[model samples]
Target: MTGESLVYVAWAAQQMNARRDEFIAGLVLVTRSEIRSLDHDSRMVDLLNASITENVVAAIHFLEHGGVEADVEAPTAALVYARALAQRDVALSALIRAYRIGHGRFVDEAMALLAAQAPPEKALPAARELVHRAASWIDTICDRVGITYEQERDRWVSSRSGLRQHWVNELLSGSAVDIVKAEDALDYRLDRNHVAAIMWAEDTVATRDVGDLFDGARSALGEALAASGPSLMVPTDEREARLWWPADRIDCAGVQAALAEREVSVRIAVGDVGYGVDGFRRSLREAERVKVVALSGGPASGRVTCYEIVAPIALMAADVGDLRLFVQRTLGALASDDERSESLRDTLREFLARNGSFSATAKAMFLHRNTIQYRVAQAMDACGVSFDDPDAIASVQIALTACRWMGSSVLRQTNPTP
Candidate 1:
């Protein structure tokens, strides 16, 4: 570029700098209109406006006095805006789009100023130089700011997740805490009804990206549960994510339907509806207990385990060793791990559960009434239990349930099934 063209660029920069506010306002208006993602709320808008002003001023300054590409740095406001976007979980692509849009408008305004200030011949050359320099500045600034956004996003999420985990652990530990402080730190209300769930990916499918998998699961769960605003999602490990919804109750059927549609192999253990702080803690505790029982049966047993359905087994699971002895004593030979004994135990359990009704047990187990009666007799002979004693029947019933869930863990067999 000739000195005359440089002089023309300087004149154009001066003109832009004089009306910097108007120029920035126009640029912000156009960028916000074109890029909807950048317009989140009033605070975000303020950040965008400040970012635009800083970027515009830097570009004009560079136009007026040529500088090495390496010497140019992204303005503080731009970096702050990028970090803000990252903290909000907004994509970096949106930030870059805002810059590109503003760059074009900036160049157009500078070119118009140059054309009016310089002679016709000098205007063309000056405009060319202006566009080149503007492009270089944008490339440099975008690279720097993009890096900043990613770094900030990782750091912010890690810190935020860690803080949330800390608070959750404190709450779960049953320690005395200031309710207001806990709510502020967690950004979750403990005064509302809560339905908690523990989710984990199957080992086979867990090799995929952990963050993406959990994030997708969170969205799916939220939609299925009809959760409003932000729900508390804290990942306790790489494969497991624990979340709570401010809901009176969870729609288990809805969750099943959603998971079926996605076809994502995941197991979720949900707790019953609880209210206030006590409910929050109790719900999570129940979910955790449910998860332990659900995973004990293997990955393919059940996809969604509700605390309500498994409440008794979950409570008994607190002391597996004690429960095992109780099962052995109550059921005797009926708790054998062998195939025949296992079948009889299952039949007898159902028979007893249906109020000692042979037809009802047969219908439920899809077997003949005679078969149900025969199995019950054999099971009774092995265990030597009597129906005449109501307390004995209740104890037998509980043991059978423990056998059904705890499987070989509570069964009386030398080599139990895995």
Candidate 2:
């Protein structure tokens, strides 16, 4: 019976096209008029007329009398009632039933249509995947740079951790510091976005007052920068230590002055807020630069000065030591008006010390590599440091480093740094 019902629906669709509009319209609206009574009076005994439209009427009649077919896509149960709407009812009830039956498949069809409209929907994701790509491009560049990518990564990590360690060790000294797990003891909300200052007082200040400084610093740090965590004081021997400040939330000068009352006079080298790890080097380099300021008055200085202000003067200090000798010995021919001769010697020495690696030497002096190369060749022509000779490069490297203690050059052999 189910198979018979399904076969009838296909027969109905095929036969409907042949039916006359007038005949179909009348059949569809049967409830409005007594079509069956009219047909009976007309003696429509043989409904299977050979005329195409008449055969269609027969098919419609047969469907209306309960003959039907299953919808492959629509629900099987709807087929029973589908014949009731077979004559195109005003309610459009049969179409509505078919829509419900096909609802799930229609949604899948819509998505497929959308996908067809767009081609190759992947660019950013492909770029992101490249992050895991094993290509050696970056590694090659770094190898030529005299530093490995991994080594650079480690250096960056160490600089940041070192800065944190410097503060943690001092702030958490003795019982106050939880050494079992140094990192956990720190209520630290820091990694990147931190800056620091190295503050020192004259040894002349009373030791109790110096202790008062630590107490005062903590109290001040709390009030001034509520957003930042507490300050960490890293002890560097007995003479000095470092203080950590979250740059975004704290003021370096205010903290420095607060310590001045108890410590009497302190030197502070303000460090920059470094990128999580890599940028920390900026802070460390600046801190090291400002140490010259601390050394200006032997760590007892009162003035709060920026390293940039004193960098040029500090650089000239070494020259001042061996300056006349450089002018006399290294630059002896300068009186003959060869201005570049001595300058070129300094350049050559820098190049050789860098192991012929233009990039490394350029970094040490903060110069460009091409400039360093040019200066090296200039220096060789002026002075006599050859690139091919390791012994010559060694001599030059030593000489460049020993520029600080120029007159004591002979003494350097007794205590060589390398």
Best by lDDT: 1
**Alpha-carbon error at 318 in model 1, in Å?**
1.5
Indicate the TM-score of model 2: 0.30
lDDT of 1 by residue, 25-49 (tens): 8888888788888865334677899
RMSD of each: 21.1, 35.1
Q: Which ten-residue region of model 1 has the weakest summed lDDT?
A: 293-302
The TM-scores, one per candidate, come to: 0.58, 0.30
Across 1-418, the per-residue lDDT of candidate 2 in tens digits comes to 3334323333333333343455434433342233232121010111212221332343334333433222112222222222222211113332333222222222233233323432334322322222211112222221322222233334433554344554453443333543344545444544646555565555566645665554455455445444356665654322345656555644545655555554444455555555543333455556655554345334333434444444443344333435334333432232122334445555666666566788888898888889888887766554353457766555444444333222222111233349
Model 2 superposed RMSD (Cα): 35.1
Off by over 4 Å in 1: 1-158, 176-178, 223-229, 251-254, 414-418
Off by over 4 Å in 2: 1-182, 217-227, 249-263, 280-282, 297-301, 311-418
Question: Which pairs clash in model 2?
Answer: 5-68, 5-69, 6-69, 6-70, 9-69
